[model samples]
Target chain A: MASTVSEVAEVTRPEQVALRSSLWHEAFLRLKKKRLAMVGLVFLLVMAVVCFIGPFFSPYASGKINTAMINKPPSFSHWLGTDSLGRDILTRLMQAGRISLTVGIASMVLSVSIGALLGALAGFYRGWVDQVIMRVADVLMTIPGLPLLFIMGAVLSEWKIPTDYRIYIVMVMLSLIGWPGLARMVRSQMLTLRESEFMQAAEVLGLRDRRKLFFHLLPNLTPLLIVVATLNVGGAILSESVLSYFGLGVVPPTPTWGNMMDAANTLIDFQKRPWLWVPPGIAIFATVISINLLGDGLRDALDPKQKR
Target chain B: MNALVEIQNLSTYFKSEQGVVKAVDALELRVHEGETVCIVGESGCGKSAAAMSLMRLIPEAVGSIVSGEIWFAGRDLRKVSKEEMRKLRGNELAMIFQEPMSSLNPVLTIGEQIMEPIMEHQGLSKKAAQARAIELIELVGIPRAKEIAKSYPYELSGGMLQRIMIAIAISCNPRLLIADEPTTALDVTIQAQILDLLRKIKDEAQTAILFITHDLGVVAEMADHVVVMYAGKVVEVSPVVELFEEPKHPYTQGLLRSKPVLNQRRAKLYSIPGQVPNPTTLGESCYFHDRCDQCLDICRVKQPPLRDGGDGRKVACWLYEEESVRGQ
Candidate 1:
């Protein structure tokens, strides 16, 4: 009788002999099924390679001035034509891509790191600590981002800061202004996870607060973090371009996408000379759209509830 | 033998928009070293609140242990430092919750989760911990320990996860295990399997268990001593066989009668008459007075205290109080 019972138990049990797919692997497989996101990813990769390496092959330097070639249209000698200073627009655009992409990526990293840390601390330890951090975030969030960025940019330019240091200032300004939204998002996410049974289990297991925060809570926040960071890149790039358009970002000679479009501000230059602004304009539009598409794809892919 | 855990007058309260809720009101219980003591009660009768109060794991912001003395391992748990309490939690005492699916971290593998308490309390190296984890998995009767170890919690069935939870709880050879309805979420067949596993572990390890359940059947099967709680207070305490055969309190009798017996035909199933009193609005009189079928005038105005009945039984009812006084 006992042997038969044991045999029945054995037969009823489903075989778990095959290795199970990990969470990340499942998310990756889901992500691959998204066609638009794949296209966005490919476009971003190609843009990155073009920006980083294309400048090396170009004949004209971003700073080079040829008086005779001033305002030349697209021709055999120069692709995308020349600007008012006779500098190659293609070379300047590539250089600007490097700066714009760097600032976007660096600021995103800085803001998300600071935001996620403060948010985790506030959400996990919810009393005076939460009140203080959330109050600060609230105050920052109430201020209009563009107006604040404009004031900071005007002040830096008025101070006659060194051209080299101005890029760093712009990066810092963007990061400082960008973190509040992400902080609040992370705080809300952490608050929901704080009451989950697994977190309570971790506490019962006597794991330290640090281990619970990083190992247990942080892994659950990965999908949210990835989606937020991807979207922030596009926002950061746009902010840098707007700052440079006002002649308050990286000084004129330093070549940023924003400064490259500053020449098109005049009605005459805007209508007649399409070469000066069209390429950079199109580049900005394409990059930002691609990033947003990719962010949406990631959001859908990482959501565990979404069926493949 | 000395009690493994002695909880005296433990009261936990929660603050809410409605008012302060006395979740556990001056609850007292004890567990011997190798015995299984089951706290049986209806839902919202403070079974889980009392269990969490023992470890001081109540949410600090919303709930607080207002007064209590949880004496374990020769020290008052309330007076101990936070660090000391943490060290004692998974080492000397451990808990397994009701919902096995949500209790285990989804991202963590079974082996990693099992090794956590072992590595934390025992300070074993990763390799040694891994080996010990495999042994524990096999001990819990999992067929392919190595394969199961590599899988995440979502990949396993509820029965498998509950067994894994048991393995983790017993990893440090804890002196006491608090299982809060460990098998309630499983099917009947799986429930029987889990109960068998728990009984085997208790005999082999000699670890005292404080089992909390709402099912009388579970209490009958597993308990050495039984505590019946109603509205956050103990109504009766007795030996298991005596509790079933000769219940003293009116509430205990009601509970036993409410259970549907197998192979018995009845036109209608039996259920207790009224709902449990709301915690926040409970008055100065006995909380169960409204629901008691045989209520005296004294039972309405004054609360009955738990008094000793003969043959090691204790009951808190106005009817029993007179008999005890006459004997005294």
Candidate 2:
């Protein structure tokens, strides 16, 4: 038994000394090696810049109604064509990109923050605290998210919530439904971490429960949380798009990618006039794919067992 | 010497799916000020559990102090509130675990980890705590203390991490330090250095240490008093020299005989036969009855109580029970 322990110590000790660097530093170094992830990162950055700045450069406003230019193909004058409402599809797409990205990021932040807190509390305290939080997550997990979102949107619209406020309401709704999975992830991670020697050391040091949870356990969980949050952003964007596509998401005038796709639901538009819908569809697909790639890269990089 | 910590009839049990496991049963031990008391036993002998039970660090979800009175600083530790226990821990009492590599927080800087208990218990300012931490790091013989303080646990070697653990354990100059197989993970040379450091701490601070280990060599080198455990019960208690020269219990005899001497080469190393009894269902008879080569008829029918063998020594065995009765 003693021999086995010393053998393990001998194997682990040298590697630990050789790799005398911070976890973030090692993860960053590993992340740099994955070329596709770097490309995805660059794409996201460029997309962010385009979404934030591209509308300022457009000749036509997102709300402008140019009847003559309506349903125009991808010409130089109306690049990516105009929508059925005579709105410049490119301008509206970029403008809607801002809202979609905002909703995605906002919802991700809200859900992850809530999830991480509940998970940390439940896992660190365990017992009834674990039971209460996890059972709530279990119940929430059973509810179909899309149908719930649809119901929430219908109820909110009936209540006459204004268009701008409804976007926030949609964010809250998505976050409410999105948190259970992330919460479960954080809880399981915290459970393992709570048993780790460092955490016990912290406990033995007479550190307060709050400090141990935040300073010791939470910091160790950052890599997992970051990966979960990144992945959730793509899901959030897709969920918002689906909600809007069904006319239950961000209202028409607000021009989310989901509502924008509402224009191409007709058989004629789906087959003949692909220009009116293809750009928004491609934009959503590209954003979600890039984010997922980045998330996958992060998971690989942050895994401590991964060799250099 | 005054007893700094006294544990009487301490029995710690774990509630598992199978049954209640009596991990430590009717254990009696003490650590005196300026003395080192080593609890020696093989694996699964409950030495570590006994140490953790002293600090009440046992997992409340599964394990508990079934029956015990841990008296420390003139108070029953079992009767103390959790808040009071927290105050006592890392201040009046501190503990160092076996796996040094895993015992320190990887994300936290050494300085931050060391400075925390000082700041928390001593109520020192951050600057003062930082200074105290640096002093501690140097005290543990780590060179370039300032620079080492900024480094994380992963950046340090196992020996260095163990020293850092010592530094942290001794930060508040605790009255009693509980070391649970502290040097087991380290190599022999580093092990000696850490043991020497612990000796230095004991001499300088006059802090009582409850040293728990499986290595009898460590017990000989460090212990003033030695407690030999078997099947969760302490079979013998004697001074270091007495334990080496005259072990009384069969289990203690088996433990000493099983250890290979450096120069006495043999075809096969000596080994004690039979495994430690399953703690949950230990029978009414002597726990060592099956394993003892010299087991008598009465040994198989009844358990032996721990009886004094004079000169501050105690042993629990049917052989000693007869001797005590004859003397009476």
Candidate 3:
């Protein structure tokens, strides 16, 4: 009976607080109260900040080979221990994170741009334009996605794709395939909202069609777009990792999580050494979970159906 | 006062899956300066279509004003470029739609929506526009004008939102205001309030109003001159008093009699039997011939042109042709 009273008190307290907050503010408060999501957010933020700031303050350069402390275990001197090639796991993880996060952000931007543009146009114009765009989307969806990514990567590599230019190529390919789903969703939403009074009001106000589409219609899509992009970044990062694991993405010495895992596969001397697998595995899991949590938080925040 | 808006021989046809529907066929009407003209018709009678054509707002792909001369503010609107039409929309003339709840931008604050016209047409400063918005809100009888200006359309009540819409429409102070069924969706008391507000606003602003509605009670309350439409054509037009006292067109008389009055009680409420003829199937004969009472034999064979009644009124019926001939 006492516990039931306490539970009621717990639920009632937040509702009182929620009444005082705006939509976004209420979402942020709810997010802050969620332990797993909060932990994920903090972890992602720390990782990003460290990756940005640590490179400038490091004593050892990224390419600098330290042969003396090769394969050292966790100790006072080395917190996460050394890699097979004597490189600091802490430094390597941070450096690798920079590439992973960059690729994740880039691909998300490209995909969202394509998706939003197509979605808005398809929705606004409808009829033939809608039909043609959706048919192309259907064809793309039928193709096995991962296999297509593999084939594209291999073809690009065989054609001597530049090491510096490979990340951009991967981003483009992923974006090209990724936009259809988002576009279809946005198109349906736009169709429903197009007949709404606000659009008619904009027309009557003599706003140019372009301005109406972007300013009035586009802002309404922001929350959904944000949610989709957050979730997609995790998927894109995971896909890139898988490609790199198979030697199709990010060529040698790029310091990626996948490449680190690949190196673990070839380490013959340490049969009992789980040191090499642990760090990279943790890095991948941490990033994916962080992105997913952020996406969930955003969905809750933006959904009009959610209670304040 | 000269005619501020003259729509002569205007025909708007829409291409639908069913066939080409004549939404507005040879609609001729005029709105003189500072006059309150109301167009009354049942649903799908092309009253709204005629209004949209005046603004050149008919969607181009499926719909087109096939032939028309829309003279507005001493210029032919049909000849104007799209850019020029845009300039005319919010600057020279403004329109208030039927559903105020849907017509307002949901994301924008009431102040911003009102200020858009000021910024676009008048080029007022944000601070000045904000001040003007509050003033306009107060003019529309919204209490706490300053605070209400910060609220979104969804946050306000239905009556409050409609008032805000009127505020936006009148912000630029256009010479003409077109209201399409401004009170159709509101409750009875709210409808009265809105109609009263519109009448008061028109008197205060001295702006010529082109009001479109299906409700005869509204026409009685608001119209100075009334145009009666059937199918897609104007069946009768006269001064409000003349229309009520002696309606020449059979359709107009039928419409006036169909209403349930306060002082009269009958076995059943009068109604025009049969549905309005579909525009696609309508021939050159009188559109309302099937349902019109006192239909002459010639009514089914030939359509009647608008004939001037003895008084300052127009009736498109063969019975009024003798008066038309005598006047000529």
Ranking by DockQ: 1, 2, 3
Give every collision pair in model 1. Answer: none
Candidates 1 onward: DockQ, in order: 0.40, 0.36, 0.28
TM-scores of all candidate predictions against the true structure? 0.91, 0.90, 0.87
Interface RMSD score of candidate 3: 9.0
Q: Model 3, stretches more than 4 Å misplaced?
A: A1-23, A26-43, A46-63, A125-177, A246-254, A267-270, A306-308, B263-267, B323-328
The best candidate by DockQ is: 1
Indicate the DockQ of the complex predicted as candidate 2.
Answer: 0.36
lDDT by residue (A264-293, candidate 1, tens digit) is 998888999999999999999999999999
Best by TM-score: 1
Per residue, candidate 3 scores C-alpha lDDT tens digits across A1-308 of: 64455335433543343344344565677677667777778888998998877766655446566788787777665667777677777777777788888888899999999998998899998989889888888899999889998999899889998888897887888889999999999999899888787787777777777877887898888889989999999988888888887878876677777767775676563365567667877888889999899888778766777755
lDDT tens readout by residue for model 2, A1-308 = 75467545644553554445566787888999998888888999999999899999998864877777668778888788887767788899999999999999999999999999998898888899999999999999999887888888899888998888989989999998888887888888888999998878877888888778888889888888999999999999999999999988899888888888887889988888898888899999999999999999999998887765
Candidate 1: C-alpha lDDT: 0.89
- For model 3, the docking class works out as acceptable
Instruction: Please identify which of the two predictions, 1 or 2, would achieve the higher DockQ against the true structure.
Output: 1
TM-score of chain A of each: 0.93, 0.91, 0.86
